[model samples]
Target: MWLLNGQSTWVNGYFYPGENIWAQCDLDCHDVDLVLYDRNGRWVAEDTLLDDLPIVQAPYEGSFAVQVIMAGCRHPRGCAVVVDSDYGF
Candidate 1:
C-alpha cells in the first residue's frame, strides 16, 4: 500500500446522459483517491473512502476520465481499477 509521491493512473472513457457509472480501486490499495472528470476536463465525481477504495458516479453524459491517485504512499505499486456503467449491464 505504498506509492511514490504524485503517482497516479488515468483512464478515459465515455458515458451517456443519465448513465449510472461507478469506479473503484483495488482492495489492497491503501489511501487511494478515485476521481472522475467530464469530457470538458471538468471534475465530476470523486471517491475518497478511508478503506482505499473509491466508487464514483458520473454527473453528466459524454466522455469521462477516471483517475486513481495515491493519497500518500512511500513505495511504488499498482492497483486494480474497476469502472462499470449501466448502459450494458
Candidate 2:
C-alpha cells in the first residue's frame, strides 16, 4: 500500500490482549510508524523507528484499531507498506 508522507490508514479488528501487529516496507521507505488505538480511539501502543519495520502490541482485548502512518519515504510518489498481524485465525 503506497501512502504519501504523513498519510495514515486504519485497521479495525478484534484483538486479544498482548496481540501483535507489524508494518513493513521496502528500503524505499525509511520511516514508518504503527499506532494501536482502542475502540474509543485511545492511544495504546506504537512503534516509530527509523527503520522500515515497525510493530505494536495490543494492550486490551476487544474492538481496537491500528493506524499505519508513513513518516518518510525515499520513493517519489509514495511508500509501499505491508501490514500484518499474528492474531486472528
**lDDT (10s digit) by residue, model 1, range 1-89:** 22344577777777776666555455555566778888777888877776455567766667788776766443456555455667743
List candidate 2 segments past 4 Å from native.
none
RMSD of 1: 3.9
Candidate 2: RMSD to truth: 1.5
Clashes counted in candidate 2 amount to 0
TM-score for each of the candidates:
0.63, 0.89
Model 1 TM-score, all chains together = 0.63
**Residue range 1-89, candidate 2, lDDT tens digits:** 78987789987878877878888987788899998888888898889877788978877778888889999887788888988878652
What lDDT score is found at residue 78 in candidate 2?
Answer: 87
